[model samples]
Target: MNHWDKFLAPYKQAVEELKIKLKGMRGQFELDSSHSPIEFVTGRVKPIASILDKASQKGIALDQLEEMQDIAGLRMMCQFVDDIHTVVNLLRNRNDFEIVEERDYISHKKTSGYRSYHVVIRYPVQTIHGEKKILAEIQIRTLAMNFWATIEHSLNYKYKGMFPADIHMRLKRAAEAAFRLDEEMSLIRGEIQEAQAFFTRKKELKQEEKN
Candidate 1:
């Protein structure tokens, strides 16, 4: 295996296992017919090119890439702003992973108006050789926040962190709109949850009839 592949193998394993575990939590809530704070879980190991770029940008030595905390990243998307907090609490209560640090960007947003709850964690993965501890980052955000952040990320790539005045202003405005959308959704979260539960029950009844 290439050096990058060999180095990233443990992180990849960590992401896969964590994705299953986190998704299982949602499954449990579904089986109980309860509202799950987690909408979906997605994960990825950083691409070698991106990792190199980040390391260079941060003046991190390539040999010391282990210091790159987010090389293995997982994102937990939520339906409402409050759901973000729920997911964060769930992570805090978990024993399989040790949360090393937390960055609450939602309350104190970035200058670019990025908003997400970042939790850095150290997780152990059992390998053929031995147990390896891998650092991973879990980013919890509402769907609206994720949408905005995705767009902003793409724009950052295009602009290379040098956005024009107009584009910068528009991005800021869009971020505000996204945040407002989350707030509006939260206001009707109870009704939304009830509607979802109703549909789930209807679907279950249909399945029973088929059986």
Candidate 2:
């Protein structure tokens, strides 16, 4: 079996259940949006294991990772950067999830220039017979971060992270620009939402006038 199948095959339902639980967790923070569904990203382990295999060949022991499933990795996409903080705070309150680590990658972007909020939470879940501890990694990011990550990922694949120097520079520039744009766009979103609400009120008033 492949690396992921080896780890996830036995825990398929558990994985999905965790996804549901995670969505509820986000909802508790009031950051839950209609568009956010806990994504199932299990197949990503293949490349990860390959990286680990490379480390092993270099004389590093990484066997434990291969069998690890509760490595509870999740990405929670939010509407704004502020929502990221909101979600993090909500996770912190619960006794069920013991916070193991917290990383504000949004403030301290990755070396590759990625940005997001990461929280490692350990929550106890009930099973058919007893309760079990499940480790879940929650990554909260704005839609802009998600867009940037998706585009950068495609470019990383298309050019294998080794594009022409000029192209790489442009990508970096775009990512930075996207960061600033995210804030501006978020403000515009609020304005637009307010405008829509106003329009709806006017429409309701006009209908009432006709009646």
Candidate 3:
């Protein structure tokens, strides 16, 4: 248990630091009274059991666990599909970490009907020993896409990957529906942003009046 904790310490640190940094980007946009491409950020270090299962499934030796990019994962949710590209560009411009790879799952969705943009990065973490570089995966998706994926993930857990035929077909349909919703929302992006900005201003005014 101690060994496992020591091994994952850096990964946990990396997830925490990256979440704060990414959320700070959203804060900067808010400070400027501009729309932030990032709606929210969430992160996690894969559980030991899940990590072991994935390693075994992929024939990745324990010594080569670092090769598994998603052991430390972060999810950045955007309001619109276009915002995903904007966030990806921002990530590319940052010097804090090196992006090792990118997978455009939104354009080339998985066979199982998953859609998201995956960015694998090598992040440097400082420890008592020294600085260690670790692989982490960031998934960018729209709110609608996330909603569909979340349900699919839960179903995957229940079915253990071999979903019933009907369930599988329904999931595929749901994925497409989610994508269409994103497209429709994108068409009205300007209106949505304007309304949200107005709501925010109203809330700020109410708070100021209380103070």
Q: How many clashes does each candidate structure show, in the order listed?
A: 0, 1, 0
| Per-model CA lDDT versus the true structure | 0.94, 0.64, 0.96
- Per residue, candidate 3 scores C-alpha lDDT tens digits across 1-211 of 9989998999999999999999999999999999999999999999999999999999999999989999999999999999999999999999999999999999899998899999999999999899999999999999888999999989998989999999999999999999999999999989999999999999999999999
TM-score each candidate.
0.98, 0.67, 0.98
**True-structure lDDT of candidate 2:** 0.64
List the lowest-lDDT window of 10 residues for candidate 3.
141-150
After superposition, which runs of candidate 2 have C-alpha atoms over 4 Å from their true positions?
A: 2-6, 9-14, 25-62, 66-71, 125-134, 158-160, 193-211
As for candidate 3, its clashing pairs are none
Q: Which stretches of candidate 3 lie over 4 Å from their true place?
A: none
When 2 and 3 are scored with TM-score, the better candidate is: 3
Where in model 1 is the C-alpha error above 4 Å?
none
lDDT per residue for candidate 2 within 1-211, as digits (tens), equals: 5866644432444456656766675454335323222222221223455546455655655665533433545677766676677667766886655888888988898766688887866656566656666555667787778788888879887886677888777777877887898788677866755675578669879999999
- Model 3 Cα shift for residue 31 (angstroms): 0.7
lDDT of 3: 0.96
